[model samples]
Target: MKTKRMNPFKPTAGGEPPLLIGRNRVIRDFEKGLDNGVGAPGRIMLITGARGTGKTVMLTVLGDKARERGWEVLEETASSGLCERLVSELRTKEGLMDKLTIRPSVSFAGASVSLGEAELSPKRMPETLRKAMAARLDILEKRSSGLLISIDEAQAASMEDMIAIATAIQHQIRERRNIAIIFAGLPQMVSDLYNDEVITFLRRARLNVLSDVSLDEVRNAFSQTFADSQMTISDSQISVAADVTKGYPYMIQLVGYYIWDAADIRDSWVVTDEDVKNGIDEAHYDLDNAVCIPELQGLSKTDREYLEAMSQSDGPSATAEVARRMGKSAQYAATYRKRLLDAYVIRETERGEVDFAVPFLREYLRKKS
Candidate 1:
């Protein structure tokens, strides 16, 4: 029996793909920002995209980069009470903050500190957060290091938390502190943040809108990754497989994962076109369930109808045609259209036309009808 190979591709969320495609520019600029000292525009990063576009992964990779440069990386999710959480994370840094406040000769032998997860009033949260964060940066400043804060799922983050984070970063910037923050959210939500007067700092930050990786990059990565795994796949076969993904970030991993699965089950190291076909079938099933299903969640009936109507078109659906299919006026339909666009479910194509943003979404919608 031949030795089995572990799959090189990862399809699950939070699993760092062995190969990162199409983000070299971001990585390069951010590392430069670390070296450029405080107030580099690259240090204030905003990553936005539709779901499955790897926004969270971008934060993780950047956090690793920051750690490599001796910066303390604080990772948090933008949920309710996020500012409160930030305070807790800062205080509980294993005496990292305490060391900065106390003298070097000071020793705490069996000294106990009572720091509970006390709820903070919204009005005072911002100030408290600023002080705590500044203390940490003060220490980093001494060592010529810095701090990098990453917040994911920022769309759901509270306005209060947003205000607090912005206020802290603004103070640090004014003081010329070596502080950086990365916010990852949906495009619509992040846009709203930028529009706010309090969060104007975000407008000046580096924006990374996640989208499809280039086909050439995806194809090359696919070939090299498989080759490194000791799997035999030709350049032509790789190109065909890469085309199937159309360069969507998550789809890249899903399709590659399934292709490897198909090849592995055959007990042959050589990947075949048939394997690609089988993989696409499996990948589509997963994509529909994983992506389409969640995307449809909480959509009103009219929203569902709008998507179903778009499915009737062979390509991009004319806005008027979609409205006609739904038996609604175009003016009435435009509301839902904007909603979908903001949510990244559908995007404007040519003038007066819209198309599904999610890959295989048309098939998924049609199947439901």
Candidate 2:
């Protein structure tokens, strides 16, 4: 018989967990940019990380802070229609549509419009979008506020939409308007997608490569969250639970969720060692399904082979050892290493040593093999 108590942990992708761990620096920097006003370097930022590393949650956190300081935030997921989505939001802001009296000469209704009138030719999209965004910015300027446009999954966004957005932002930059944009994606694809000359401004934007929290951060988060729920667990139990999470945000939340659930199922408020143990067991499969499976699914046979060979080592595997195990030359191994590094599936530890960036990936890979 389980209690009807609410679970404090959120394990879903992009979902804000009960408490954000070790993210004050990034959040504060973005705020410092907003506080400093126009043309601040941190105003334009690019965030890159492996899956479940809280990239989206950081976007959400930044959006909340901007709103608190009276800045309008346009949080969007990158896709083919990114420009269209951004333009749509800019066009429909209250009291804004009435101000943009149309030019009356409407040719084609696609992605180009003479301000506030949606739909026009692709060739004219950047122009119409710029004008609409300018109108919105003008209103914000009067209020001493600013605009922040954040795009997630930027790797998947089409180049055309990206260019259109870049062009509009470029115009605002030239005019020195108070505006900011953040783009988040897997580390591997960020450089290729943002390296185009047209969006060269992005090249100069601050780059933040997000990773995991320290074990101490995880320990404190677990202690605080559990204490808030009015549950009592010894420091040793908390340490055991925190160590099991290994500082991965997804597992942190997932393990905490099950720990709470384990207590709920026992119809008790006190969390026992058994509860923490059970939570770790249950969280492992859910983590694998949520993160590891999708990541492994994207690997090629060679990539899988490289990972499998690397999994033989308990810790970070040396590139030479991994290559020798595969009966291939180090040169052959270097290619897959770069691919995996770019994909953010594996990260270089020290010198030529590499380890799985995805948590519990070694156990999962070994189990599969």
Candidate 3:
């Protein structure tokens, strides 16, 4: 039978390719925790990575899985007034009774709220929010078995608000065995969480740090995605595409999108090496003009210096090394490291090595250096 053509190169709302790879183990671990009571001592999981590393997508997938297991899910973003918006969303007239489903108890609210006649700002009342969150989870436990709260872009949240949120989770939520919280953000999220006095308690929560996609997985993902669309491409072409992207999820989609479009124009069902090359060139040009340039404009002088130094280094440098290179003190270099992390400009590897979080950013920094 003839197959239908589907585009494999479009960016989904969750910022992930339709096919996700190298995450089965992580997903299973989370599922096990939720199924077995959030682990022996109880824990939350933090998934951190660089920008465009599929952190958001991982959260969404996990949220979906949690729902299938009958856990209540609450999702919030870390924009401006997230806390106030969450309280208002949860405290509606219908309240917790209306948000539960067989799938999972799910609720969503923003950081801003519109009162009957005015807009209210987000606040940092840790104690109050703690109580409220506990109450909501209690209701979910009665209806479903447990509750899972997922927060995206958590690093973007205000430091004070993060502390308040962390306080509530550590103090109020920790007392209950029926709730779990999952936070996903950039690598700097760890620093932000550590700033809170209650962070030691928070650290008891589990941590899941995402990494880059593997070359083999990237090839299979792209090949399968296109195959499902009734298109055939040689392995060599797929490898070239993967090489150009370095297995970055966002770049994978960008390259695939253009290649599929090119094939459609020529009425060809097969993608060739030449097609892949052209697609990559197009993606690089577009990214340079759009995303890369704008991000460069946002960097401060210190950010640029740290990025250049790290790009030239073999691995993550200690505070002393970074400071010595810049003729500054270790303490001063540490501050710049935090800033770079907060800005999603750099990330730490498992071996305590640090490097540019985004490959395109590294390329851009190399050019400037």
- Candidate 1, TM-score vs. the true structure? 0.90
lDDT of 1 by residue, 273-314 (tens): 899899988988899889989999999999999999999998
Better of 1 and 3 by lDDT: 1
Error of 3 at 264 (Å): 2.7
Minimum summed lDDT over a 10-residue window in model 1 is located at 98-107
Per-model TM-score, in order, reads: 0.90, 0.88, 0.77
Best-first order by lDDT: 2, 1, 3
Candidate 1 backbone overlaps, count: 0
List the candidate 2 regions with Cα displacement exceeding 4 Å. Answer: 1-4, 94-123
lDDT of each: 0.85, 0.86, 0.70
Candidate 1, lDDT over the whole model: 0.85
**lDDT tens readout by residue for model 3, 1-369:** 234366666554375567776777778878887767735432388888766667888888888888898876778888886766565555542264322121132233734422321222234366556756776766766776676778899888887677667777766544755777788887778767866675666677667777778988988888888888877888888888888888777677788888876776667888876777788888877766655677668778887787677766655555556677787777777888878766776666544457667778767666667
Error of 1 at 299 (Å): 1.1
TM-score of 2: 0.88
Predicted candidate 1, C-alpha RMSD? 5.5
Which candidate wins on TM-score?
1
Highest-lDDT candidate: 2
The model with the greater lDDT, 2 or 3, is 2
